[model samples]
Target chain A: MKIINFILFPFLFSISTFAAPTWYPMPAEAYKFGQLYPKAQQLLFAFDYGHALVYERLLQNRGLITDPKEFEKKILDAVMKILKNPPTVKVDEDDIAPLYVYTFPLMVDTFDWSHMLHQFVLDVLATSKDRGPAMNRRVNELFIDYKKNKPLAITDVCKTMLFMDGQFFSKDFRRQYPSFNLLIWSYHWFQIKLYEALLKPTKAERDIAVDQVTNDFWTLISDLPDSADFDMMPETRKEAPNFYKAFPLISASFDNNHMLHDIVSDILASKKVPSSEMRKNGIDFARMAMDPEAFKSNNCGAE
Target chain B: MKFLALAVLLCSQMLFANQKAILVNASPNAQFYRDLILKVRQSGEFTLPIPGAQSSLTYSFDFDQPVFPETLMGDIHDSFNPIYFFRSFWDKILFKDGSYLLINGEKLPLTCLFVSGQDNRFSDKKLLSPLLPEFVLKVYLVANDFSCQGPVKPGWPATGGREENWDTYLYYEIKDPTIMLPMDAKLRYRWNEYSLVLVDRGSK
Candidate 1:
């Protein structure tokens, strides 16, 4: 009995040693930063839920693209309901999967890496002291540090737009999934605009900017397929040109992140690949086809 | 002129950079605490096992350089990692596992910790991010009756800037000059104060 147990220990140890994937998280304080940008945070929260639902819907047998009616019934209608009443908190992504590991095992981590930076910039703005010192310096400093963090970092801006424009990827997903696509574009619009708003001097002012952005989100989202928001994903460089001017890498990184999100959805909705491999293949397409490891972006008022 | 401004900045940092820590021996009931410390080391995944908590803790990587982020907002860990100590002390406990004091139901003297770090660099490249110019967190395992050998001594007067206290508070000191990356001037590097500590302000 002892000999049998001893021999089995090695095998058990090797199997047990298999490492599990983990989420990339923002600094603890980033969560507290939500207080300053409640609406944007809520939208960000909704985006988390939206990602899971959209992915799960795409995984549905034959999905909507195969039968346009089911797509409207299952995907479009649900998004409209969500727009009317959004979630208040960022969701626990683990519960979203009816089937554990439905998306690529790394999907949650990949989103989390970009999400952490998203919140990190918010925290920098949120933490700025009134009239104490310029925050740009610190914001810029932290941005550089954030990129240095890997396994915890999603890629920065890709040099090319072809990844989002390729055969497997294009406007088809959004064209088909308008409401959900609009919802995601709404998330990016405010997320990018908030950077511009954060450059405001005070939280009260920032609060007002957030409200305006929120209103802008609703205005655009309500316009449906013809909405102005659907024209293009929010370009950080164009929307918050000063921020983009200062920290092109982080701005580009964030823009790339949103672009990839859309691109991956396109790949999934197209259903060219097997449902099981959709997410895995999509992630591969994102990293390999669109390499943004070189440029991360963020801007504190100073260097 | 620049020297004077720099001096004031440094002086102010010296006065307030107090990341005080309390190292309680792992008593019998605290066996879980001891084992956890042993499991995490030299900067890996860290989640403080706040009993009955539903979420994990995350580090903000304080960016103020010599200063740390706010650790506690009240009775909660505002934004900081759990006890980070040196890897060398992974097996250096002095108390029997599971032996700890309970004061009003709160576990006394939490698990031992050792932070390895260095002087905050002022160079342009090094100043990019918090994690860029920082060290790692290690754990210390000791048996019962093991008092902390780290810079922070129990019941030391607060804010005096003693050699041991300041060094521990700021997280620096050299045990081995040869192997200096971990030490490079970092031991007990500044971390957010995750727990509340009562200040004794000299009898009012």
Candidate 2:
């Protein structure tokens, strides 16, 4: 009896201590639109990898320099090649940025899940013929599923830019790497604009608008710091008003995700943040991003 | 004593119920699966290889479904999971850990392996999504034991059998002509390269 008790106690303890892995399977309809617009999908995939590469380089201090322009030329050149010939599928970020992934898996997971939501919305728009209420209903369902994994979900509540820029280490990444910063904003600009393009009534219009948007995106980043949207990160409300009016929750979530992206870059690039504290800071900021109470009291709808 | 035994049985059953894989079943929930398949067909993303093979392989993707992380990985490694195979996770570990898979009774020799990629550009001129059938399959017999050696781990079978190869590569894919996702997708089996197609058991 005593021997059995000892063995059982240890077995149960081991089982209890193990952290169960959790992930949600994407809906079947999600990847259908990806087929229709392979180019757009590929670019999105490239953007995903670009984000990882920047974070990894910043955090690992790999080829990092004091001069932002030199660093941008080097990194952006590599990134441009990827954009030219982007991957067909999702890039395993950990492979590209192991330290970043393992250091802040939660934050990384949050971003990945939000990215999935981004794809979900695209799928909803691309697949559904009925662009009005039916599309909204499907997107609403996807949003619910997006929120299923609470730890991985970014809050839909709109937080002001102050939450992002107010921190001590907030604007350092952008200030130091202005061109590189603009490049990321350009990526965000295209992401939101694609939704606007997809919102066009006809497939012909959508195709032309998407191409125009893609061309515009390239134009925006052509000269780097000079032509970029340096005034602010692309807000979904302004860049994609149709999408915003249709689904404020998803739009806010995208806005929050973009905000988190900046916050993460700032944390990684800030010299004020100790190397060891970067992960902690990243996680702390992620929690603040996920906090619903951080919503605008009356100014929520202002932005 | 009887009450205690019944109580324990009920508790275990409840736990088992919670872990059950949500797949094709005769429940009303099956409607969700039907709608998905319809959407796939409507989008022209996938189709049955044979017109009458409706029962071939159907998958229900409940995005909100709670799945144990290992279960997802297990589906990929099981060699018989289903129509869709995600290889992104496996590719990361494949070179480091080495992989062994049994497809159509052939025990893949673990040596230097290079899985050949399909040409995404087709004569139809339509660019297909990488998440389709062909892209999903990772088991092209390009060069087995070709100029490379992988680390062999201990307690790994000195003998042969499907069960013994614990680190099996994810296998199985849609029979429809077009598909590919960089690393995540299905395993398409070529009859000339191998024999027999195994339905993904995980889908059941």
Candidate 3:
């Protein structure tokens, strides 16, 4: 083990020393949705912090959680604290989890790629006029262009069965970390709900709808859900039904991605894995989830 | 096009109003501000730079418009320069921070300042707001900063991804009357790279 660490330490340092520039073409509708409804974006701003902070805290305090649920509670408290006054700008993720990157470099890239999809949808909806026909074309164009670059696209199928409490899954992560998991679920709950706003034609109508959704998000955060209670991961088909009709494949991918959000968290927080091997375990789960046959789901059961 | 004329008109109006209403112990050129505001309001692009020491900070702005997207650094040129660039933050870290803030003295309630910036292309621990007067400022919107970060990632269109460290901020500038405010409508640093694209999100 010592020898392996010595061999890999320099590699990590060098990779960090000379990294590639990360950027993307801002979708044509970059900040338009936010301009249309500032509060909606603010909600997302809070989630960005929550999302990154979760990975940071989990990795920072790996193996400390003998009581996963209790730890999840603490994490929720932290997320709510952040939601109260989210940072006005994005914080450096690499800065947040520098040491962890030495091990889980792949997770960082996958997270960034998935995040771009989230922002891309908001952009598409921003340009799409209240779920009009143009919505389909714009979304398709973006999906095609985005897929062309792939941007670390999660092509494999990470089925719901993988997340089941089998031998691989344990009580430590999910049973202990319910609220934190729910917080993520809740973050996603609103992610799909955001599309409903597009159904409204004008800015004022969209604003009113977005405000309602924003209010809905705050309700969830302020009244944290019961521990280990993600209440079943949100499905794009169920949440974004209109979108489901338009882009079934893409929509399924998002639901799969959301499920993996939990899967990764589950594995990271599990008591089954030793603290030292958590990164390796996370990568394993990431790989399995990336496997198209395993991760991709055309239908995650009717319900 | 009309903002300059409106600015001049607003200055004159402030002068007129301040002289006419002597009830509040008005400052010497009290009317200049009101006139400038009215003129700006009259002229269409109702963007105003915060006056005083902080007002001098360089700024570059890009509205979320529909058009071809370009890297912020790419878009920035001789005619359009942001008040603070990536290097500006670094320079401040090494030397004295160049950002100016005279708001403690009474100025029109500071509200929502939207700054367009970049993120870390490399290692930089400098977080601008964490070091500033945090109590006085409330940050509501921060993107491009967090969304684009971490290991070998692909770039996207319109932005210089994680490598560029491009970010944005919308802060609520508190209105304090104690501050000695500017009389003219020029709301940018001395270099003045771009016209202020600031909008009134609301006042503090």
- TM-score of every prediction relative to native: 0.51, 0.60, 0.56
Cα lDDT of model 3 by residue, A1-303, tens digit: 232233223422332221422435656675555555656765676676577656766765665645556566666666676677564443434433443444566666666666666666776776675466777777777666555645466653436544434436544455666667677888888888787566557767867877887787777766656432355777777777766766766766666667667766666666667777767876766565456776334555356
TM-score of 2: 0.60
In order, candidate lDDTs are 0.48, 0.58, 0.48
Interface RMSD of each: 25.0, 20.1, 20.9
Q: lDDT: which candidate is best?
A: 2
Report the C-alpha displacement of residue A226, candidate 1, in angstroms: 2.2
Per-model TM-score of chain B: 0.20, 0.23, 0.16
TM-score of 1: 0.51
Write candidate 2's Cα lDDT for A1-303 as tens digits: 232233223322222111322234657677666777888888887887688877876765633455666666777777777787777655456535555776676778788778877887887788788968887898899899889888878888888888788888888888888888898999999989988898888889988988898889889988888988569888999989988888888888899999989988888888888877877887888888888777443466564
Which stretches of model 2 miss by more than 4 angstroms?
A1-25, A62-66, A295-297, B1-204
DockQ of 2: 0.04
The docking category that best describes candidate 3 is incorrect
For residue A108, model 2's alpha carbon misses the true position, in angstroms, by 0.4
Give lDDT tens digits, candidate 1, residues B3-114.
9999997876554333213311221122332333233322211122245663222211111111112111111111222122111112233333343333224333223334
